[model samples]
Target: MTNNMTLGQRFLANEWSALAVAILVGLVVLASMSPAFLTEFNLYVMLRSFCVVLIVAFAQMLTLAVGHMNLSVGALGGLVAIAVGGMMEKWGFPVPVAVLAGLAIGAAGGLINGLLTVRTGINGFIITLATASAFTGINLGITESIPFYNLPAGFVAFGTGRLYALPYLLLPPVLIALALAFFLARTVPGRQLLAVGGNPHAAELSGIPRDRVIVMAHTLSGLLAGAAAILAVAQLGSAQPSIGVDWLLMSFAAPIIGGAALTGGHISVAATALAVVLIVIIQNGMVLAKVDPYWVQFLLGALILAAVGLNRLRAVRAGGA
Candidate 1:
């Protein structure tokens, strides 16, 4: 009985519980209102949408876990998309090679962001904000706001391929979520990263090499952002300069709503995944309900504000307890 109560309490305390309930409610309401909502094609579209957003959410989640923010996530992703697209179209590089190169570029960009933040004593927000501008400028310069239209057939096929009702694109985020869960829960470096986020001074005193962990977090964030960019390219069958333009909000929204601490050292991969699902559902619901396109931005902002407020309340209650 004691164990059961403990488990129940833990579930209630988890941020994912609220999100899960919301998702269930959304699904029920949408399905009842729209006969097309649960159709195979609609379900596939929703799952496909989840692929890129989930990875982007994880990218921001990693930075948040280190008590930092990467305002450049969307910018970095856009730059990478353009780079890879150019490699395949202009330079005629094979898809695999271009992808590997893009990933490397992303890591390098992240490394620079981390080094600048640590060495200059600048807040990550400012550093990444500056870098975001640089990235956007480079992207615009290269493509002149035009997208790469010609991509490898195999690559484009992967983006559109579905196994029955399941999108092949769903595999990456699921694997990433599992890997992130294991890394955070079991690995020494992951623990160190979380430790630094939880309390940097204590972690430094404990010989955790705080700076290194921070850099690692940023680098991993970049890599994930790059991966998402690539997936976006595949999904769209074109490399648009605007691929990640909207990721900034969703990137922060999913993790924050999933219960990532702003101060860091606390995040739940499972919860984040559920949060993404909920967001996707909400977006889909709006489309099915024929909500005005202009209202989507307003709705997103309102949801984010609600999530932040709820988190603050939870923090206060925990403190009081």
Candidate 2:
């Protein structure tokens, strides 16, 4: 009965309900496939692991809401994580200082994307794809093929500690994402940002300062990615340069597969969270079922194809009807 409701109404009622259903179903299937999957320990492991991806996905989803994509997110995230670790190891900087450094790097990364998109008049794909290369190069430059380790004590607390049976580290990403969602949904600037992304020309005509929104949106994405980098470092206890590379694909996959569109104008933070969890479950199930990582990639590709096909068909049918 709920599934039959209009999407608009459903979105208003529970943006993440569909994703929650998917995750639950995935969990059940995985549990049935393997008896060991139901333990609280496994739950903790999965949640902890999924946090970084969820953080990145939320950042990506922000750009998607306004008709942009940040291909450099993974690289930037990795770079920041590495930076945090490097600072702690070499300079003995406090966790807060290192974390701030990471955030600064992220914000700058986002600002670059924004400037390029607006100034060059290039499509998002071209701008971000090029920026991704640069970000990767920056990573190589900073780490120089060696990873840094042994971050400060405070950094370790958020990632490895548990709070009331939940990962204490879950606090950062969850809070950041929720704050971002509220901003996008309830704030005036956020609305303008959405409007600009949804229909830039129209927004410009209506005096929305579309260019400013582009910069601001990209900056927000960058900040979130930076925060995610800190979380990654805290959780892993080291700043691995390659930590966020896999996230490039996973981050976008979460929201788009969950229900967000590529063409912009739609944003659902809650739904995006559920979407990311579902992805984590799929990976978890594959691991529990002893499936190869290669097969998981193929499965993800197949699901994405199916989702795109279904959506395109729905759009066509709606137009005709």
Candidate 3:
């Protein structure tokens, strides 16, 4: 059976190949349509934008791996951004200390979400939704809807620095993606996470500790959210209350478009990264074409629906095959 597949058939059957083709086509078309599309500065801008969103998508992807959803991803990110900002500006903390504290805060928030869901036996959707509101409330209460200006100049420089078309901000996400891929494919806990997501009863029967895996996923989600928030602060040169305001859409879109199963137990780090690349291309193309920014939001909404439909169709086909 394995020897019978033709090269073309195998390429078509591999999920990421389609996205790779789409991206190549998009790059060619956009470059032809707009001369500025391939310019070094524009390339840097697109790569910079890709960094934080990739992490945010990873945050959601981890939770999705366990058949759970995290409505609080954006809210928790917003909270962490301000908390880190305040640590730096108000408390006079250094960058490393502030960043570590922010990550810890994110982990703590995720811990709360996981514990509540596990202990109460509530749907994660409901648990995260409720916590989303709570996180937002705390964010608003802390800053009074204000932003933090005057971050360290060195941090800001790292955010905007680039070599040719490669952004310095690109490094962390690349390392993270590699680490995540390795974890999911090679590590025991990571494999256990997918197992729990794939079949809770079977995993439990196998002594895989289903509850522990769910909690771990949520905690990792929160940690990624924190990383994203820090990146956002660096990119903008300030910590704004609106940092994670629009992350909800992109977070879900990237992973789903990249072929993650909402049913859990399936994901691909490389595919998700490519999906982010495709999204960035679309956005950059729209900007070059001078389309209204609001249309970008509408397009994202439409893309989500299309991706979901495509996933359903693929699942049906796979089941039949």
Candidate 4:
């Protein structure tokens, strides 16, 4: 009986379980409410939407795991979008080369954020916020608010291609999720990153290079943000200056809702993925049910508040236990 009770406690404390349950519940409710919810086209739309958001969520999640936050995820993504788009459109660079360049640019941006934060002893939030502004400035300066419309035929085709109800674009996020889950669960560096976030003092005492780990987290976050930007360009079949404008909220919301600790050290990629699905479901359902588009923002805010409250309650319960 004691063993069973302990297992139950652990289960309740697991964020993945909560998110999984929520996804299942949302699916059932939406499917029942809207006949079109399960249609091939609607399902394809939802899955396609999931791709970029999931990657962006992971970007923020990596920062959260290192006891930091990247306030510039959207800005960084927008910058990368324009960078890659410009390369493809103006320079006439091949898709592969442009993508590699974009990823490198993303890493460099992240490296700058990490270095600035560690060297100045400033909070990452502040550093990222400043960089975010800089990135947006550069993006606007280069494009003057215009977008790149001419992308490679192959790239555009991949973005729009589907197999039954599954989108070809879904493959990247799935692979990324698996890679991340493995990195976090099975790798030494991954564990060290978590250690730093969970307890910096302890991590330092144990010989982990705390500063390096923090920087690595930010760098990885930037890289992921860049990848998401590339995917966004593909999905939209154009590179818009506003590519990541709305990503900041979703970036934070999905991870937090999926059980990432704001204080750092804990996050679940799978859970965050599920949280994105839930958000997508909510947005799609709103359209199906004819809910006002403005209400979507309100609902998203409410969900974030609810998730935070629930996390606090869970923390209190664990403390009492």
Candidate 1: tens digits of C-alpha lDDT, residues 50-121 = 999999999999999999999999999999999999999999999999999999988888888888988888
lDDT of 1: 0.91
lDDT of 4: 0.92
Model 3, 1-118: lDDT tens digits are: 3356577656655779878998999999999989999899999999999999999999999999999989999999999999999999899899999999999999989989998999
lDDT by residue for model 4 over 1-321, one digit each (tens)?
224447767777767777777788989999998899999999999999999999999999999998899998899999999999999999999999999999999988999999999999999989999999999999999999999999899988999999999999999989999999999999999999999999999999999999999999999999999999999999999999999999999999999998888889999888898889899988998999999999889999999998888788778767777
Tell me each candidate's RMSD, in Å, in order.
Answer: 2.1, 3.1, 1.4, 1.5
Candidate 1 residue 147 C-alpha distance from true site, Å: 1.0
How high is the CA lDDT of each candidate model?
0.91, 0.81, 0.91, 0.92
lDDT string, candidate 2, 235-285, tens digits: 888888887888877878888876678888877777778777787788888
What is the TM-score (0 to 1) of candidate 1?
A: 0.95
The TM-scores, one per candidate, come to: 0.95, 0.91, 0.97, 0.97
Where does candidate 4 have its weakest 10-residue lDDT segment? 1-10
Task: Flag regions of model 3 displaced more than 4 Å.
Answer: 1-9
- Model 1: residues with Cα > 4 Å off, grouped in runs: 1-12
Best by lDDT: 4
Q: What's the lDDT of the predicted structure labeled candidate 2?
A: 0.81
